[model samples]
Target: MAEPELALDPIFLLGAGRCGSTFQQVRLCETGNVWIWGEHSGVLAGLFRWGGEAANNRQLTKYVYPREPVSSAEEIETLQHDGRGMAWMNGFRRPDLMAAQRALVLELFAKRLPPGKTRWGFKEIRYGPADRVPLNLLRMFPAGRIVHTVRAPFASIESAIVAWELPTVVALVEQNDQAALDALYLKHLDRWNGITGYLLDLQERWPRKVRTSRIEHYEDERRELFAFLSLEAPTGSAGARIFSKADTAGGYPGIARAFAERRERFEARVAANAGRAGYG
Candidate 1:
């Protein structure tokens, strides 16, 4: 069978939860021919994990079939008589496996496009450097572009805790446990640091393929972002709705207090990493 041709190269919008990724998606789609889908809850990341394992396994590499099949009867006979022949766990060819993986991904993301939409992609918050998702995804779609969105860590954590209704964060706030809240901030800060560091590395490695945007500066960066993706920048504030703040219903004051108390810690961590990421 022949390999399927993808109509458009995929674009991955990656960020921690509560970042303005959805806003970015909306703006990208406003170009009229792009359809950037919502998060699938790390489904693609899970698939990439499986592919990475199979691709790197030493045993699979050693036993996998040759790229070209043996045509000669003498070669077949030699293989049949050899102590380590194709009969023992005859594995698949890596190229075939990769092609199959690409086909499956295209079926999921690109096959069903809305009318007038020729490009397709998705936004995901569950993938970070630790998951090796970016590396594996680039392997699958070398022409793919990644937009790494970021928000102030405290603001993001505060919004995520409320948006997701995290039990631990709720309990800590209810108990008014200042120390626990500080610790929590530090924990999330470490994770954010790691993700930001990885994203910076990606931008450096693939300067043309990776771009980073901060939520607070989205308005200013909007034109540049559209141009980066080769899309015509839309006029007017059609995306104002996406930038609207959610109604935290008087609950954010408490959350704000928790974050405020740990402001120094947050600043220190951001200073250590944000400068390198060009977010400072």
Candidate 2:
């Protein structure tokens, strides 16, 4: 069966969790002609990884298909018999595999468009360079654009700990587990560094197809963002409600004391990462 074509080229909003990407998605949807969906929990990333393995299979490339067409039933029988001994006898062609992948993605993300919407896309937080998401996504949708959203590492990490009720944070607050908290903080800091580094590399490779959006500069970057997406800026604060107050009410006494003890080191790490990610 043939797959349906997408109504328009897609947009992928990529960011770490708690990076205001949800707000960016909502704001983009306010354009009335666009529909930006939420995360699918890395399903597409997994699919891409699976496809990548197949695409890179050297044995499949060498043995799956004949260099020339078979001319006789005896030759076909011989090939079939030989194929029966191999593990990947039915390996797929690259183009066919990509088509199948695109069809599945369209079914999941773009099949049922709302009446007035002409474009559709999704926001995901779980993809990083290791997943090769941007690379595979571009192969599937050559015209697609990627928006890499970012927030300050310290604020983003703090927000994620509270909002997600991370175990390390809980232990730090309740059990005074400073070592666990330190490990957790370092893990997230490494993640931020990797994601930001990947984004910068992607931008360098595909400058016209990728853009970075920072939470702190959302208001100032509004016009540029809309323009980049070829969207009309919503007029007169039509989408002004996109911004929500940051959740900063709770006090983490243990965390505070720890930060006081390690403020210089933490600040230096954040500054180094933020600078790499194009933040001031």
Q: Best candidate, TM-score-wise?
A: 1
Which parts of model 2 are misplaced by more than 4 Å? 1-5, 65-91, 238-246, 259-263
lDDT for model 1, on a 0 to 1 scale? Answer: 0.75
Clashes in model 2: which pairs? none
lDDT of 1 at 99: 79
Write candidate 1's Cα lDDT for 1-280 as tens digits: 9744556578889877677889888878877788999998788767777777887878766666443555566776678666666464343577766877787888899966787887889998888777878777787888888999988666666566556655677688889988887787777777677777788788889988989888788778878887888878787764465434552324556776676767665687667667775555
Which residue pairs collide in model 1, if any?
none
- What TM-scores do the predictions have? 0.86, 0.85
- Report every candidate's CA lDDT: 0.75, 0.74
Model 1: weakest 10-residue lDDT segment is 241-250
